[model samples]
Target: MTDESPAFPPPPPPMGAPAAPPAATPALPWYRRRWWKFPAWAWLTAAVVLIAAGAAGGAKKDEDNASADTTVESVADAATTDAPPTATDAPTTEAATTTTVAPTTTRATTTTRATTTTTTSPPTTAAPQPIVFSGRGDDVVNLPDTDLMVATISHSGRSNFVIWALGFDLQETDLLVNVIGGYSGRVPVNMNADTMSLQVEADGDWTI
Candidate 1:
């Protein structure tokens, strides 16, 4: 027997000769390989379980996204819809204006009038003068023409006293007074007399 454990490497071939292959390692058995140690049924069940877990994870992600979108839509609707007004949104008003009125006073006026009196007197009138005619016995007297007048025929005699009148030519004649004792009476010398001549018959003086 030769020495089986040689410590030195193999010698190279000549410069032109092809190198020889390294020694081949011995192969392991199928049972000892890592890929074929378990049964086929275990692999088939594990593959099916892995596929199912992937599908379930995808479906759960989709459900979560849809729930989140629905919650966001609900929040948006609550924010945009109608609502009652608050105290801060109400309108403000100013205070009312105040006015004062003044009172008025009235005064009355009075008027006075003065009265005066005047005295008046009537004018003085003088008495008319008496006409005088005197005769002692029967006589004829021409009487002056006069206006309508009333005169007293006065005789101062105890015997008969007579007064008569005559016209211008002594044709018209009339008896005026015939008296016995002292006589004082009145007679009217009017238009019919016409200032005629008068005849007086007396025992004493006679005047008119």
Candidate 2:
């Protein structure tokens, strides 16, 4: 009784002995377990956001380039339609020319002639000689030296056939002249007379 002293306390561990280990904590979920896991996830999320934004920006830039090309093509077409035409596109024409010439002429001429005149004269004639007459009776008369004679006689008688005779003596020959009683006209004779004489007779009274 008295000896049952209070349960004695356990004795102290000896020197150089290992201490007892602490009790282990319970295992958490995979997300909560590592301290660096949260920062790695945040970095991955930032990388994904950057890639999506870059793709969207690339698509928008391509759309803007297509619109610019279309606008340039429309401007070029309008400029071509408004320009003026060149010299080769216009029409061509030709002109005509003419020349004229005059003609020459010649004329003919004529010649003239002159007129002439003539004059004439008359012929010359010899003069005549006078004659001597004898009465009706027988008579003898001397004559001049001449070669030609003209004589006339007249008688008063009723007989139609009475003869009258006369004779002349030349130098070498004798010529006899005869007349009828009724003769009254003149007679002409030609003879050669060196010397000349005349004799007259009639049957009746005669005049010469």
Candidate 3:
């Protein structure tokens, strides 16, 4: 064996100086790379869900506002269109007043009538007079005659004088005497000297 190993010739220097290589191999086509694609599907689904939730919230707020507006409108209409009271439906104070007035008037009229009735009156009576006889001194002055006579006269000269009574044989009797030319009948005397005088005077007929 040769005592010293023969030195191998130095390795030949690397070809061209050591160079930076390309970054990576070419990616697979879209249809063929399957392992990491599930993450991409998950991101797309999350985005779609977020959009649907926002739309639903907006629709719910609009419905609530519309309902509140409808309630307010109904209240306003009720306030403006109420009905008024009618004549028959109101209280009856006037009827009471009318009834009271009628009764008062009737009472007053009745009182007046009663007062008038309380104030009236009545009548009276008369008297009586005495019977008498009268005559004038005239033509037939008789003496002891069987006939006895009595007379009456009217002062007004409107009617004839008449003898109202007579006596015969001293028994009194009624007799009629008729005379003319403003002369009453006669004056008489008896044998016993019972002389009688007669005359006519004014203020109605009287005996003396």
C-alpha RMSD by candidate, in order: 31.2, 38.6, 32.3
After best superposition, candidate 3 residue 143: deviation in angstroms? 99
- What is the lDDT of every predicted structure here? 0.77, 0.59, 0.46
Candidate 2 error regions (>4 Å): 1-115, 126-129, 157-176, 203-205
Q: Best to worst by lDDT, what's the order?
A: 1, 2, 3
Q: TM-score for each prediction?
A: 0.38, 0.33, 0.22
Report how far residue 166 has shifted in candidate 1, in Å. 3.4
Minimal lDDT window, size 10, model 1: 1-10
Q: Please, what are the lDDT tens digits per residue for candidate 2 over residues 1-208?
A: 1222234644566789876564344455555545465577877988999999999999999999999999999999999998887758557566677777767666677777766666666776766657666455566556665776766656664343222222253332334445555666665534443436656555566655
Total colliding residue pairs, candidate 3:
0
Best by TM-score: 1
Cα lDDT for residue 103, candidate 3: 47
Worst-scoring 10-residue span by lDDT in model 3: 138-147
For model 3, the local distance difference test gives 0.46
Q: Model 1 TM-score?
A: 0.38
- Candidate 3 per-residue lDDT over residues 151-204, each given as its tens digit: 333333334543322234433233334443343333332323332333233323
**Model 1: residues with Cα > 4 Å off, grouped in runs:** 1-125, 170-174, 191-193
